[model samples]
Target: MTENLPFIEITDIIQSLANKRSTGTLELSRDGEPTTYLFFREGMIQHLKAPRSQVILGKALYQLNLIDEADYELTLSDYAQTGRRYGEVLAELGLVSEEGLRQALSFQAREDLQNVLTWKQVQTRFHGSSQPLSDVFSESDLEFELQMGGMSLLMEAARREDEWSLVREHIPHEDDVLRLSAPGAIKAEDLEVRITLLIDGYRSAYEIADAAPCNTLECLHQLAELVREGKLVTLEPLELIELGHEAELDDDHEKALKLYQLARSRGQDGFDLRRRIARAHHMLGHKQEALERWLEVAERCAEAERADLAIATLKEVIELYPTDLHLRQRLVPLLVANAAKADAALQLRNLIALAETNGESPQLLTDLMNQLLELDPSDRPTLKALATLHREEGDGVLAMGRLDELATLEVEADRLEEAILAYREILEIDPENLNARLRLAESYAGLGSTDDAVAEYRGLADILYNSGLIANSINWPFLIRVYESIVELEPSSTPAWEWLAKAYIENNQRDLAISRYLGMAQSLRPTPGEPPSPALISPLARVVELDPTRLEVCYELAHTYLALEMRVEAGRTLRQLAEEALRQEDVPKARSAYQEAIEIDPFDLVSRRGMAALHELQGDLDLAFGIWLLCAELCQRVGLLSEGRSDARRALAISASDPRALKVSAALEALAEEPQAAAALLLRYAEIMHERENSGLALEAIAQARRLDPARVARHPLLSLLSTGNTPRSGAPLR
Candidate 1:
């Protein structure tokens, strides 16, 4: 809520000392209707819940302090929970003259939206010690901070001439199409005026936004939310933007080249324009030309003193450009040098999600982060990135420093355990960091530590409990594990037996983990909010599916079905879990998630990639390999190749080769194994190259040598003799 905070100021907060925390809302619009939005850094507008009407919107805003004191509190007492609009609230109170209510209505119509937050408009009246803004709230609530800082931003932005008011609801949106209230409410008797704008039609959305000080974002977000909710009915645009700079060409390459020429000659031939043309060049069988064009865009953007723009354009170029040792050697570190301020966090969020979505190379992550760290100086993210890079590069101890700082700041910032592992990492260094030792114990317990994980849970428990604290949230799973361990050690603690039973149910192990749940179920005891356990589901269902619920067991069910492509069964199982969550009041979100039985397999890759696991489990390598091959192929087709490669290599490691993979690789032209087939394919390629003299003699020679020694060929012995039959091949005569 500070005035005129520049983008640089936001970055300053991003780079601030002592973790200056604020939840950001890029104020999209305040003109349309009184609505708020939640947009992630990934450029996704997740939810757009709006007010029921303008009067209700104004009332909320008045209460939050956009209105003068007299207007806000006067009608406040007369407000009814089940009542209608604010103008009516005023009528009931009789504080405002009829003229005043009409005046309010007039103002409401001209103003499109009012974003409101409670914390910003008023300070806490509670008397106590001062605390960090974040510490004043419950662990479960983000509202305190939102009300304080976020709320004012909403109000200020709402009062803006054209932006949509940003509002926060107690409940996050579960529906794709959320209901937002318009700013003006008429009496129910006034049927014509009572009609709220639909805001669903694109034309309607634009008109609403245009009514006052408008931010395109509010409209965009509403559209995004509608699209997410299945509420958005997309109509084909009457005027689709077409390529008009140049006429269509005979082929893709000609089209790309012609487009590039046209842009350079006529269009907005800046970085983005040229970059787009360069990308087309790559796709249209002109890779070198594409690279050159991208380089040209980068050079131009750089010379124009638009370094940030240059960085973005260059990154795009890097993504499209063919990666090579020489190019990557010069390119990777340079990308770091050119990356813009605050772009790391933004890029990481966008790229990781994109990488996840598109199944792009994870090497992209490594490269981007590494450059970010190297280029940026002492920035927290940069420092942390350095730490992650070290750990990823097998320098765990080295990473400990960065992880430690991150953990401290993260914990101080109330980030939970997202960074605490770094604190535990210090253990490997000090082996006696008693403070870190205690923190590590807490961390392990937080991670659902088993009894055998470490022997210090009791110590941690004793310390916290004796000191009159909550004892690390009394994690029932960890307690069960501890009790189970005690049972193993002493074998007959009645307390252990009783606690284990209770813990079993809390830990979601109904039938097997504790037979006592079933025993308790038959007792027909009401367990708090739950129905008498026996009637919850059939006792028959419990008895029907009782096996040790190993991680593998959970996965095997999901994986086997997926391996067979049983979408209905997969979706059914997923839906049940989702429905269970829904019953728990976890709203159905638009994102793919697991409900009762998670059909979404975050851990299924393990079962599919049985590398050492297959060996260790006394399972068949051939079967595991078959499984991995199938999963890899399926995952690859779905653009989950990183998942595929991890599994594929694990499977490949079992026997060092798979001709089928080679064939598949041969078909896709990306797999780098089974050199005999690959080499044979290359030989054929070389002959074509030599006959056509593709590019030049240098290209033909390169292809010939490549058949002998293809670069980055996966380590397979056959690749060694991959040349023409010039050397003795296993049993073939030496030439």
Candidate 2:
């Protein structure tokens, strides 16, 4: 005998007996359920006896048409009196032949095995009889003729197990009753007549299988098909409750609640039913219906004086919604009404703590905390709340003491932000509380508030510095590390960068100081369209001071100067950048630097000359002449006539016949009031244009020369061509 084996072990027990060729009866049983027996002869199944719910042999024989209903009833009565098997009685009366008896017996054994396989747990016992098959039951009983191979029956059971999963989708449970959805809608061929006759809205699928001609799996499959076709459906209320129970057993609370709610809509109601529904809702997660149902059950149980039940129900809800202040408050009074003083006090304490932390109104929280304190004066959470109230009321001296205590508690609880806030309050009450500030800083750093932490650290450093720690260099390294963190958090913090740099220098790591500044400047590269950052200035300037040949650094420094409206300094920096770039033979870099310098101060003659020289080096004569002319124009505008004349001469030297150069040169000479020199330049300009067939331009130039010096223009050779109307393709009109 084997006890408490898993349901799957039935197959192993059957196979082991078959392999051993043991002749015995295997009894399968579960607690609170009927036992099933399988009789084997030479390891082949010959007979089975299962519960009436699982197998009704006479009804199965009648349903399979092996015997008529009359024959089934007649044989059952005769077999009872004759002390013979029902099938043997049927065969004796010729109601069912011997072959029919064997077939019915085979069907019974298959049904029994299938049902046994579906059970979740079982106990088994094998009684080895050691008797011949004919002697086990008399030859007249015909048990010897009804043998089935054990392995083949087990294989059939396995197939049914697989198909049961699919059949279960529509017919969720075997005990679920199925009925015609609309009697007129069901056609004759849609379902077998025998099965249809059993669908009286009262019989379960398992019962229908026993009373129908088909096996259990086939009957279930047919019912599922009818369900899918909408010709049949599981009966409501009863079937829903059954399914709910099944789901509940499976711990599928959501499905159980759905099915139970469906049953309630169909008029299934009771106190226990509603309580079960409430529990399902609670397990599935709350809906308003679930909450109301739970509340109703709790109230009913409380009125019934079932305090334990009521308390347990409320406790379940509270566990799910711990911070629900109203729920906790309600639970507290319920515990008190139940005379559970210890539990009541614990709940009250929890309520007070929750109110304090759950952002309840200040008045309500104050009342709760005061009540808790009255009962238990040493409650830490209540004390913390009172201290917070004192701080808010501006009782600083009293608040400071409470806040220090609160901060320590919060730190131990690992609530770093709360601890930081408490420490901040302490510092507010006593601004020079270095200990509080230090704790606050450390907590801030722990919570990733690096900038805030560094700010507090700097405050501490300042307090110490004013106390003359800096004179002895006692905390200089501390000062350095603090500033390093500050800059690390915000690389572009100007003051932090300066402090770090100075700290590095005092530590005699000047190169490291320079590297830090350089790193800072690199991090501050300005995005396009954004205003230049002020923080970029000192770092870039420092880096430039360390190595002036850092042209890119110098270039950014120049832009920062321009942003600050320091035009002279910007121009100076750009010039330095251009000189350095030129020394490196980077013509493009030098050109850009000079271009920026000229943009900052349009009349910067030195940058203009440098740009002009770079253009000349790059074989760009036109650009060179243009820059020279622009320089001369700027000089004239600024009242530097000699400088203007020199720039103009430079332009003419680049392109002797270029009209723009000649015009600029003439203008500069006129600005210097040298009429002859101006006239000569204009005449030269006119001659070059006339030779290029630009007679109109030439005539305009001659007109300008005449304005400068009329006598010199009259002596020009172009004047004779203008008089002859031999002006090229276009006639010229002198202005």
Candidate 3:
């Protein structure tokens, strides 16, 4: 710093410090040595925290909650800015104010506040607080006390003086960014920068002059630049401020005059100083002695409260002299009703009432009235708001007593139904009001009301449904109990039956749902001892019983039995059902289903013929013949159809003699006459005759050809064809 300029003079900041208005921390320097400090509205230095540079950066950013380790590295990376204050960068970063930057620079300039404050009023140190800076610091806008000499000397001046309207700083680094510290600015390009090469730590500011050989002032100019950018920071050492003497004051005298005129003048705001004073007296066992002091505070606070300064006064009392009983008691109900803790508020209430005051003020009674209003809770719509409030405040037994009294009064007023309704309301609000449900049910039962009793039971069911703790085995039993009462009231209830079935299903008893329907199906059964004649099951009713799922159920069951070697039983059941379908004239179902049954027992000739006859009635000649052939083979195998195949054999024989059979025979013979590929011709005719169910016809055709021309018939393909005269037994034996 220039030796010609004096160090920073602290006398300049006395008034703002005393009034609790100026806040941000401080830094000072002297003789090129950096010192760090904090100035609070609370007056006493907050903390000297660290060296000037670190603390200055920390406190400024701390105001913005941005001083985490992350921001320091970010700022260093971008140290060059077109001319602007460090506080502008801080403002852009939203860390500090334009007014704050001016004050910081002015403090670093050792300026007078009246002079500093006057200069501020005369010229805008920063962009208007609201207009907010964007860029540019004008030379006309800033005038610094030139600290002439070397770089280090100028840095020293920047730190010590607390006066300057603006700053310009020079920074050295590998890469640079211009940081504007004003809140906002106008076209900032005219702002200037001075970049320097940082020398090794050993080099003094004089060496900077050597490095800048053509400019001796380069060192001084660099240091001046650094200061403007807020890179230089330090604090002047302190000698405490004197307010007034405490020695002559009487401890018990009137407070407003004595305390303010003497002790509080130096405090940032008197409340903070008064708190420490109260604490000292409190710790010294001067409770009654200090009562007079607390009374003055409470009186000041009460006056503030009456003037609607309640929030500030309350904060002062609570955060400061919190142990005062009169103050706490007066404030507790206000706090509680406003959503503060009730128990803490109550503790203060109880303690204050117990205090040994010689005589109470009307304020005390007024406090009691408010507290009582908060305490009473008043009445309610359904809940008796008072009782509900207490219950919610966690006094359940108290709630119960209130309800009991209500119930008694209701009974005396001959409102039994209302009393019952009240009880029901409780149960509605908390359905686990099992005692009420039981009492209500008994009341209904006393009046011989089954419907009311049933309603109570259903309410219990709703509870069980919600809780899910009803025992699994007993659920149906409970449902049945409700159902019995329901039916007792209305005998023809379909919904009751449905609910019972659903309950059975929920318990996984599928047979129960089907059993009732099955009994209906079976009641239509012919009498008890008679065989199940197909006539016994009505076609429509049987259709319903044998629903799609039931059809699948029986089909799957049969396959399972077949797989388990119970083929005969599977066949018996399937054939009977298929025959039943045929009697109903469901021809396709009878044909295919009986065919499948016959397939399960290849030896059952009757089963096979029964299938063939159904197919024939449906005009499926090929299918009829195929089933007939299977019956013939099965019968012949078991020797059952060798002679008596019932109408199936007769029908098959009749169809085999048809005129279409003759056409098949003719096609086979004409195709055999093609000599070049007689084998291919024979095979083609065989496929057609086979598809047409003329295997018998094809055999018979060979017999006819032999009768016409023996050599040709004998020479035809197939094992039976080679036997001439004696007809090789015709037709494939059906499977």
lDDT of 2 by residue, 1-735 (tens): 233334567778888778888786677888978877777788887676656534566766875777776787787787678868676676667777767766776676666677777666577777777543333344444444457787987898788777888888888766666778886657778877767888876567777876776666677888888888888888778677877888799998876777777677768876567777988877776756677887787887888888788888888877866777777676777776766767876887888777767777777866666665555554566666677887677667766776787787788888898898889878877888888988998787677676777678778877777877653222456677777888788876766777677557555687888888876776676788877777778788888887887887788788789987989999999999999988998877888889888888777899999988888888898899888888888888888999899989988888788788788888889889999999999898887788778778888988888998998788766798876866654334433
Q: Between candidates 1 and 2, name the one with more favorable TM-score.
A: 2
Model 2 alpha-carbon miss at residue 603, Å? 99
Q: Between which residue pairs do clashes occur in model 2?
A: none
Q: In order, what lDDT does every prediction score?
A: 0.44, 0.76, 0.44
Deviation from native of the Cα of residue 41 in model 1, angstroms? 74
Best by TM-score: 2
The alpha-carbon deviation from the true structure for residue 462 of candidate 2, after best TM-score superposition, in angstroms, is 85
Given candidate 1, what's the lDDT at residue 68?
Answer: 52
TM-score of each: 0.22, 0.33, 0.20
Tens-digit per-residue lDDT, 1-735, candidate 1: 322333332212223311333333333223433433222222221122224433343443343334554666554544555455566665565656655554444344223223233213221111111232332323322221222233333435445523223311211221112223333322334221212244432233333433312233444444444444443333221110023222224244444344345435533455656766676677676767777887787678768876666666667665665343323333443444554345544554444444445555546755555555454433466556557657667776667766676676766665546545566566665554556656665555455664422444455555566667744634445666677787657544545554566456445576644454344333443445543332323222333245422222323344334445664555444443333433454433211224222334433443234223433245666766666666667666766655666655555566453545533333333443444544554443433333343324324434443565565332433233333323332343312
C-alpha RMSD of candidate 2: 24.3
Q: Residue 681 of model 3: what lDDT?
A: 30
Q: Is candidate 2 or 3 superior in TM-score?
A: 2
